[model samples]
Target chain A: MSINEKDELLYNMENRDVETPQPRVKRGGVHRPFLFGFATALCLVYLMDLGFEAYKFATLRETVQVASGELQTSWPPPPPYTEVARVARYVVHISDWASLATISTAAPIKGFPFANTASVSDGPVGLSSGTPYFYISNLDFTGKDLLTDARTTVSLSEAQSDYCHTSGFDPEDPRCARILLSGSIVEVKNGTEEATFARTALFSRHPVMKTWPIGHHFFFAKLNISHIYVLDFFGGASDVSVQDYYKATPFP
Target chain B: MSINEKDELLYNMENRDVETPQPRVKRGGVHRPFLFGFATALCLVYLMDLGFEAYKFATLRETVQVASGELQTSWPPPPPYTEVARVARYVVHISDWASLATISTAAPIKGFPFANTASVSDGPVGLSSGTPYFYISNLDFTGKDLLTDARTTVSLSEAQSDYCHTSGFDPEDPRCARILLSGSIVEVKNGTEEATFARTALFSRHPVMKTWPIGHHFFFAKLNISHIYVLDFFGGASDVSVQDYYKATPFP
Candidate 1:
């Protein structure tokens, strides 16, 4: 097409909403196969969302059935201050959510720290990997902050788990155990095995994550930790080397 | 004095428990009135502890007396998402703990972001100041981080409050509300009105703060917030100006 015709076609496409489908769209010489593929992808995404909702419903039904019979939940966690590496790994595994702190790069408040209550998991239920994953959107300040400075911290407290609350350990007490780490945050490229694993780890613990608005452009990011500082006793923070953090098992 | 005499004196002091009354504690050349004054101070402190225990016992009895007549607590938080300033203030006031995010400057992890699970309060009970205060010990990583880089962020979620859990709002939902702030963390000088306010605000919410070890060199700190971002509803963060944030009345 000539330049004038191309400009006219682009203007029409830009102004038109999806609901205002143009029967004459192909008249601008746009190909049919491209539109067909785009439409198919959209339908598949919708179907996947529906499938996820159905799965959650079934899971909730099973949980309710189980709860009616027994009110107690099977909480398995190591005693606080037992061993530094082991406790750190166990807290990371069982805690469903934590605040992710990052250095801000936003206008006028740049370089300050920012934190958000985040849905996080190291691996799927009953499987501990010692690495926390996040599914986040760029629309959020945290996502933008990570892009500018990927040095991040994920701090988890055993108070987040029912075991601590039930055992009468107050959150501020050192005996409740807390883990703080400094790490590098990196985005998981779409269409990769790590991305898949990240999604599974997050969604299994926080099923609502699967239903967040798609327009937000959610992506998975993982923190590769270099330092681990834990507090589980009165004297001082526990001596947990990064080498010990990753290799330690979540359970005895 | 001979070295053996000095050693003997030290051994006697160490071997004698608190129950043993030394007829000649001054025989080792220790002053008499100094030791007596110290013992008197210790006894006064113990008596004060007993008084506090009695006060708590009476308070518990009063609460039990009141509970017989009412099934609900007199919690007076504004309905979630009612007004931006009011809700933000309420969350900060009612939340006993939040994650304090600071730019790390500690050795081996300098310049990275660090988060610590912190106990916080905005004001003494029922009087919301719309500013969060922290009682922190310099021995903790967060305290050290803030000292080097006072720029900090405090993120709070309504999930920390019973409002969300009772109303069936998920912690991650926008309706559950969240607050993000960037500010400078400064030590509240002792004997200042703000320091008194900080202590009152903190101790009233986190009663355990009053009992934390004194050797840790705890201090009162408050975030002089420059920016406030609040998410109380679906579209995006509410446009809450700093002046509005400070002056906004907590409730009618």
Candidate 2:
């Protein structure tokens, strides 16, 4: 039969109830003809559907294979450094204020504990002009903390103003900036020229140093500059330039 | 003296310029006093800023620590499959024709060596009961290509009449439905009872199968089921149940 004829036949069979045999079957007897015809129609339709689905699956597999092969053969290796540099610059933010700390060690002892009181400055090298200075009393706990430990970290950023009303200050008013230089305290001996030069520099840079009283020992703590972290509202610096500036030296 | 008195004295000294001294020369340089005063002010401000920053950092650090601890302790375990079954009835689109192929052992397969044939269907699962069967001969290269690589994909979706016209068919005709299936051929098997059974199951649930022929010794090739996309324009198969009705029996 032609394709059209075959389809018509199937369609007719699908709509019609199956014809029974010449002898009448019992009323409750299985509706055998209907069941058979329905089953046959369902089977035909299902087989046809599978045929179509298989066609679709095969086509996609071939496309994927071809595309994958083309990808494997393509060219110049991708750039490496460009991506890394892009990521580094994307992480910097800014605010205000910072604290810096460094490690200090005396001659006899090694790996002393951390001390919290010391003046930290970003100023001139040695006793030169424009040197930054910090002043702390010898009796302060931070000073004692610094005496044992030379290495320290300084944090820089803004203060949260959540309790200005309770503290009797206007929330809008700017608060004092705080800088903590923590490291071991070293006494500048009377006759040591190098230590004296350093002491002179510190005194010149800070008015408080000159008035701190005569004969009071000024110990110059050697700074362990490597452990410094200059954290601003912006992220901390890992590069050497910011570290050296905090240490008040060209080199550690 | 009060803090105001000390400040006035410093301001007066700061405004003065240095001159040649007579009996005993001044120990410090001409700019020393000014530098000292400025450095002292800076140091105070810097220290204050540092304190504020430290407090902020400590607070943030504590918060993060607590949050991390909580997260670690309160993570939920894996969910049961019962949750997955809740949304299982959403209909997924399948193409009009799904070609199935049996991979030919004789071909030297490079990427995909399977030889197959393409079959087109009227709708998603299979042909509907009353739809006319369109003759899609293997003689057509589109049909031929699909048979060669049973892996093909076809889409039956709404499109502008122009697109349908480009496919060499009249889009204006009510009987016309957009059918696009492309895939590679996997295999071509002889018509058999087992094959008939498998085909019935594949097609009954699939709208496309109803329009295709059955019980004919025709090419049965595997379809590329992955990435089967469909867009139905005449709203075909929307009312058809998507349940796996043919799961137990060979035919639905």
Candidate 3:
């Protein structure tokens, strides 16, 4: 060993003796060996406890199971049922798709009220306009229905989400919440500012719409909401004014 | 020690000596102390491994997570998309609730197409009738609309279940599957056999309907399906005849 290293080892040994005072073992007094052993055992137990927690964290990650297709992610709680306007708007804002009902113009079942599954957006993410926009093709049934009769109603249910189903509330339960938007779906005039905004709103929510075939004669249309119907609680449906619906923020 | 125990101990020692031949450690043979230490270490490692596995299993039980509202349970995989009739029936059979669209007779928004969330059932559990039954009251918007015009459409989507969302499919995507049943809503005559069956079907699927106020004059109704529209694949929607839709088993 080098001379300096040898000196450092001697100093460390001397310092250790000074730091840990010698224990006394006498009748009616604490025993040094027993106390030392107990302290060592406690440290070992603390280390094992920490190791178990780390192991549990790893286990949780490995055992994560996806239920119904809903990833285990957290979202804001829904608004209370008393806020009819807010609940109505919240349903529209959160849903990516809904049932669009229109008077059919096509044959076989012409003039009947037809409901088709449609994807829609109120506005771009984080911007709730209370207006539902659609990107539809003239070739599809809903598109054909829209072209023939502009009058339509979009139906949205909290049941469409895990919200009601998981809460043990039946989809039809008033507390589960349902919204119906009745209005005329008008095609935005091409090249208009509203049309541009509609495209941005619909495409941002449904990215695949951007790559849809052009030959299908797809066009942008929006629901000019006239009347709002909300069923959020037991007393029956309420018709909220369009102005109040617009004034209320869905975030509330 | 007792004479008999002393003799047994002596026998055991002699047997052990005979069973375990002494290792020659003159220079190149195995050493006793080293072998004993290694064996003891191996035993401790095995016990630790077993303890770790038990700990992991306990951790898994404690950390179970519920996603969306879907309880972690196993369900059969959906039928292939090409089975148009089967897919249509499957969408109807699997859905517990759907969007019921009807022509409105109420004033203000009267004569407009109105969509309402309705809970429906095809038949009692395990009996797929390919026909949807409803429990409606004249007090509700849907019931009032039905009183005016019986023509309606019930829209069902695989999106209602976690199937589409968990599979990364948008609700509007054709592969997500949607069914539109266009038909006339006819009330089952009260006190008749059909009414009895309708009540059984509707009540079984939606238990909450049983507790709905009797004052609302809730009555049973069924859709006399005339046409079926199914969109389950990338191609355009298919027009499946009502006959084929009934003939195909949803289980297939």
Candidate 4:
């Protein structure tokens, strides 16, 4: 065909919109064979989606079951107590102001020979509360030392004197409760309502509170309680008095 | 003394109002040597209290300084870019359905002749701009497979096709960008407002949206863009059509 004719034919074909009829082929021949490409592709894609869905469902179910199990075992009642008893304790030390004057007794002096002499004025005394409470003057060296190194041991003895054979003393030579407290000394305010109640209890129970002035200090300490050790002298023989009097009660 | 005499003496002593006199000792004698107990106790106590106070003060100072430093360093400025440019390219596999049909090319048919027909009654055609977007029916096997594994690779040609040789194509012989994205497939709803915006942008760039039905299946994936190979097919030519088009107009 001529070049112009070929160009004309291409233009006619491009613009045509005629419908074509279906073709026929012999039965069971290669031309008429069934194509499995589309079916196989469809099956593979469907199977993959199903597998992913199944995996996701299983993982979610397991997580839920584990959370339920944890919730079930979290709540129960507390255990019973079988070993409860009382204990008495005390701490003694060589008075820092007057080394010769020792904390020989924690009880009231009642005009003893060493009560108010030049070498022995009324010294600050610590009570047997879980956290110790004591009176101190801003001028005393012992008070300053306690504020610095709050961790110190005080000695204790049941015997009233070095000679155990003194009258009105026990003959069996029983052991005495001794303890040491180790913690930092912090200054806290006495602004809480409970402070007044604590002061009243101190005045009624301690002779020193009644005898000496103790309300002038700017800061009082709220000690952090760490540990406690009680050495029982008479064991179970004097259980009632020892337990009731010596147990350290925590401050409010 | 007899018991009667001792009792009388004790009663008299208790009621006595007599004051005790101070004792005097010689200053230069060995018995009058200076005592160091009081001085030593005071020194020790004072040193301890001072040490504890120093420690507490140092710790508190350190904590406060650290917190202040953190607070100071936490404020600054941000960046100035508005629309960040991200280039994403991918490869996709495509399958076209064909049907057997016959018609006269130049003259009328004289005898029966066989023709190979492709099943193209109801199928899809794949296309791409920067990323390939699939449009398939729910019953298609390829669609099912994509939902299942969602992992696939496209075998691309190294030679440029007719699409890349268009009249306005900037790079004369461009090396096609090929990438394989393997990830789990998710179906997103196109009826929502966010989907509507995304669909409009996609459809505006490609005319295939007019042929595909709405709400048909499509894959949403987290694609891994990798295996990049750059070829100097266009002799390192830089395409400046986009830049020229953008710079043709003066700034407002």
Candidate 5:
């Protein structure tokens, strides 16, 4: 059609009033086909919503189903308690932050065991490297403490996530699970292959770390993981030998 | 009115067809008054929904607002960096759990700084005691560690909540805030006033603590705050005198 004719047709389509065909009844504004199309679109949208909800429910099943409240995305159901080493690694792998305990050399409270919260990574999302890496600056107490004494214990807990809260397990409850990696925490030298891997592992989980101010003297450090301890059941703490802990896969 | 007459009237009200009057058109069915009533009801419901949403946003402001992302209930905007004591108390008061650092006497890593996750309460919600109380059992390594040496430091972070993460602050970033209350963690003598307060402080936040196994020998313990250190700004850590820390109010 010519441009003027096409424009005229478009205007008619946009501005024309829908006609109702009933002989006696007055027109109710909306056309029948348009109403039918709207209803069909609603049904399609509803089905898409249901599909999306189902997808969310399936992928986020890590969230526990609590008896009396809203659901939360949870860590993978902790491995069977009998699989001690696997449970330990599961706690380590899911935790993005850990508490590093170091002997303080700072004055007054000098020589005391000081705990500092440190963001950590074992590896990226699906890959568990079995070693906890830290992005720390010398200005912080934990970093300063490490400068004086490298001995530290990195603590990870299932309580960090919604798992324990939704499951009704107290943070201190052994059933809630806690993992401790004890050893010397030493800084990885710049330009080393391990440092590169540590950067990927940490920055992937905490993207904002890369933008931190350079004046803080941030460096990559890791736990030597000489000893492993896990609390996952009623009986007491479990000791997972370092050898077995490294061999176990957190994701089953 | 007679029962039958009242019933007949109710039936007419319920079953009568709504009449729409017009000049040349046949009945269009719905009554004008009924339509007006439905529209008014819808308006009221919409207003109530808006009010409820506003209430939720106001009451749960602890979650932070980031430049890009869904809004979250933020913690009270953190105190200025200059208010060192208030900032320290703020971290301790809002945190329901903390990482306790103790010198381990456990066999494998004897004499190492071991960190354990502990559910802590400074006081019930809105009541800041400035002292962290713990519901710990002897079965856990922390309990055993306490038995050997009471010297410990309780570490807390704003990162424990969604505030830091949502605000894009890395957990280790000093601006994200960390508080270390250094002192001895000692058990309160049973049946004392302090022990009763400690129970209220802990169980109020962690209701499940009341149901933990009885054989575990759980007891109430408090951190005797001797030194307070807060890392909230770029320069380095700030020390809030113990007296000043107790005097400051977290919620202002």
Candidate 6:
């Protein structure tokens, strides 16, 4: 370690203080050992837990016992369910993926509701616009369906989030909270400011999209939040105004 | 203790012989402490891991750090992604709940695609028929939406499962596997054999469904699978015939 870093570490170790209330700049390097130790302990506990689970599996009937599935976590805290607008924005902000339901364009299945899992984003990282955007390729069925029928709704669940699981709420439970954005999913007009914003929003959240084959005819489609359904409580679904949905600040 | 019970425990404990593997008749009660100890250890480890997660939260920036969401796991292992039919059935059978999408009936958003999260089941616990059934309330939006438009899709993702997380796959990753069954959803006529099977399926997996408010005008609904879209591989999504989907058993 550098002499300066070594001196800083020694001083912090001697003080052993969280209450010292150091400035934010100094805070970054300090207490790293405590963080490391804490993380290590946690991982050890998780590993042991995994071992114990395996042992239990060995004793159970010879069936594949599924392990506990926790959702992939992301940044930004969820808003209180009572704040429908904010919660709707929060869900759309943190969830990088959702099910996009579109009208079927193929023969025999025409007019039927076709649900496809899709990667999505509302805006750039650290900036959420409460509008969902998608990168689609004609090579994909969702893109085909979108082109034929622009009407679509992108539904996001707290099931796609850590909020529901951490709070021990069943994804199906009304209290778990879900949001559906209904409107025409039109391609962002090429070369428009919206298209630029959409591309940044999608590529930032789904980095792989940037590397996707260009020959596939990729285009950006966004859900114009003409209608919003927010299921945040037990009384059934409530209508969330598009204005409020877009206005609610997820970061705050 | 009865002589038979004591002898059985003595033999099993002393032998610790798993190779012989006896019949179900002797399965009622045995090696409970070993089971209990195993369970307790697992629980402790899980709690410590949870504690560790919480501690990490304390040190991070005050953003809503989504928790690591672990999907609820069950048995009878998942099928290979190559077996579209088997994989589809496995995802549905193991996932106790999924998001159901339907056409909305409300005046403002009427005709717009509306999505709702729901608890669903295909068949009785051991008799999965690969048909999704739902217990709905007329008092809720989903039932109303269904009434207006039975054309709906029930979307299931291995993301709602432990499979993806265990395999270290992102939910958005094609390898994570997602299934979309598009068709008409209809009310399973009460007193029919199918209704009976549907109830057993729904209740067995989601026991709490049995106790939901009766006054909510709850009834059973099942998706008449007409088209199946299985995305379990990297190349792209492929169509799975409903027949193959139903014929492919999850256990196999």
Which whole-number lDDT from 0 to 100 does residue A186 have in model 1?
Answer: 85
DockQ of each: 0.13, 0.01, 0.23, 0.00, 0.21, 0.16
- Model 5 chain B: worst 10 consecutive residues (lDDT sum): B65-74
Candidate 2: RMSD to truth:
44.5
Clashes in each model (backbone N, CA, C under 3 Å)?
A: 0, 117, 1, 17, 8, 10
Can you write out model 5's per-residue Cα lDDT over A1-252, one digit (the tens) per residue? 999999998887776654323432223854333344445545665687699999987765465321101111234677888999999888888887789999998988999999988888888877899999998888777888888889999988776665665456666767878898999988889999999999999888777787878887899988998998888987778889999999999878
CA lDDT for candidate 2: 0.29
lDDT of 6 by residue, A108-181 (tens): 67877667778788887668888888887777767888777777778888776545555556667777778888
Error of 2 at A201 (Å): 2.7
Model 1: clashing residue pairs?
none
RMSD to the hidden true structure, all candidates: 39.9, 44.5, 16.3, 52.6, 16.7, 23.9
Candidate 4 displacement at residue A88 in angstroms: 3.5
Question: Per-residue lDDT tens digits of candidate 4, residues A1-252?
Answer: 999999988877876544343344223542221223233434555687699899976554332110010011111111111111222222221111111111112122111101000011111232324333333343332244444344322212222111222122121212322222223334434767535544543333332334444454523343343332233343322222323433522111
Q: Which scores better on DockQ, 3 or 4? A: 3
Off by over 4 Å in 2: A1-137, A155-190, A214-216, A232-252, B1-252
Q: Mind giving the per-residue lDDT tens digits that candidate 4 earns over B1-252? A: 999999989987876655443333223441221123233434555687699899986654332110010011111111111111111111121111111111112112111111111111011122222222333344332244344334332212111111211211211122322111212223435576534443543333323444444455443222222222222232321222222322321111
B13-101 per-residue lDDT for model 1 (tens digits): 88776548666335456444444444554566568769999998655433211000001123455544748877777666666667888
Off by over 4 Å in 6: A1-72, A189-193, B1-71, B75-77, B124-127, B165-170
Supply the DockQ value of model 6: 0.16
Q: CA lDDT, every prediction?
A: 0.72, 0.29, 0.78, 0.27, 0.78, 0.73
> Which model, 2 or 6, shows the larger TM-score?
6
- Each prediction's fraction of true contacts recovered: 0.38, 0.00, 0.55, 0.00, 0.51, 0.40
Model 6, residue A252: what's the lDDT?
65
The residue-by-residue lDDT of candidate 2 on A1-252, one tens digit each, is: 999999998877876565433433223553334344445545655687699899976654332110010011111111122222111111100111122222213222122111121233323222222122344444432344455543343322112111212222221111211112222234444477645555654443333445444444445433332222222211212222323443332211
Q: Which stretches of candidate 4 lie over 4 Å from their true place?
A: A1-85, A89-129, A154-157, A160-174, A207-223, A233-252, B1-252
lDDT for residue B115 in candidate 5, whole number 0-100: 92
Q: What is the TM-score of each candidate against the true structure?
A: 0.68, 0.20, 0.72, 0.21, 0.76, 0.69
Fnat of candidate 2: 0.00
